[model samples]
Target: MHAEVGDTVVVHGRTVGTTDRRGTVVEARGSDGPYLVKFDDGHESLVFPGPDVSVEARA
Candidate 1:
């Protein structure tokens, strides 16, 4: 639930047709990383992680 800047956030898909979303951790806000996500749909969003989301540190 806690992540730093430059981390990678992946929205795990439960179904096969459900595509996974990937975004870079642009800024850290509150206890989690409020990610600046760029999707293939040509849109971006600032998201705060919920309990179901998974976060990976940038190497």
Candidate 2:
């Protein structure tokens, strides 16, 4: 999951009638590219499972 700024993030949701959402990495906060991300809906949060977060590439 090595992602870059502008790269989209996808995760599985927990319930039916709802799907995982996608967000873009807005800033690289760590040594690796996994970064602080912001969704299209204007929501922002840190990706979980630190190592699970990765760089997808530039948009």
Candidate 3:
């Protein structure tokens, strides 16, 4: 998926009973990214999205 800055990234839990993680794309690298995301829980990290991740537009 193509993600831009200000987009919301949802990292779904792979297994049952696990909570999904929500974060915003603070920085988007071109192509298959190593995106910089700032999570709602107040931390920042670089994420490479996979099948388990979904991207949403900032609303």
Candidate 4:
């Protein structure tokens, strides 16, 4: 996956009863690697997301 700053990342819940989460890509690590995301909850994480994640461009 590829993303840049200002992009929105959506992480689908891993199991039932869990809610999906959305975050903004605050930092792009490399051409194809991990990314730093600031979640809606005010938490930040360096995520190496899998197929369950989707990126929405910032237009």
Go through the candidates in order and give each one's C-alpha lDDT. Answer: 0.73, 0.64, 0.91, 0.90
Model 1: which residue pairs collide?
A: none
In TM-score terms, candidate 1 sits at 0.70
Q: 1-59, model 4: which lDDT tens digit per residue?
A: 88989999999998999899999999999976499999999999987869889999899
- Residue 56 in candidate 3 has what lDDT? 94
Work out the TM-score per prediction.
0.70, 0.62, 0.90, 0.92
All models, RMSD in angstroms: 2.4, 3.1, 1.0, 0.8
**lDDT (tens digit, per residue) of candidate 2 on 17-48:** 77666778787676564467787688998875
**Residue 26 in candidate 4 has what lDDT?**
91
Model 2, global lDDT? 0.64
Candidate 2 clashes between residue pairs 3 or more apart in a chain or in different chains: 1-54, 1-55, 2-54, 2-55, 2-56, 3-54, 3-55, 3-56
Which 10 successive residues of model 2 have the least lDDT summed?
48-57
Model 2 residue-pair collision total? 8
Which lDDT tens digits does candidate 3 get at residues 3-58? 88999999999899999999999998876678999999999999998999999987
- Give the poorly placed runs of model 3, Cα more than 4 Å off: none
RMSD score of candidate 1 (Å) = 2.4
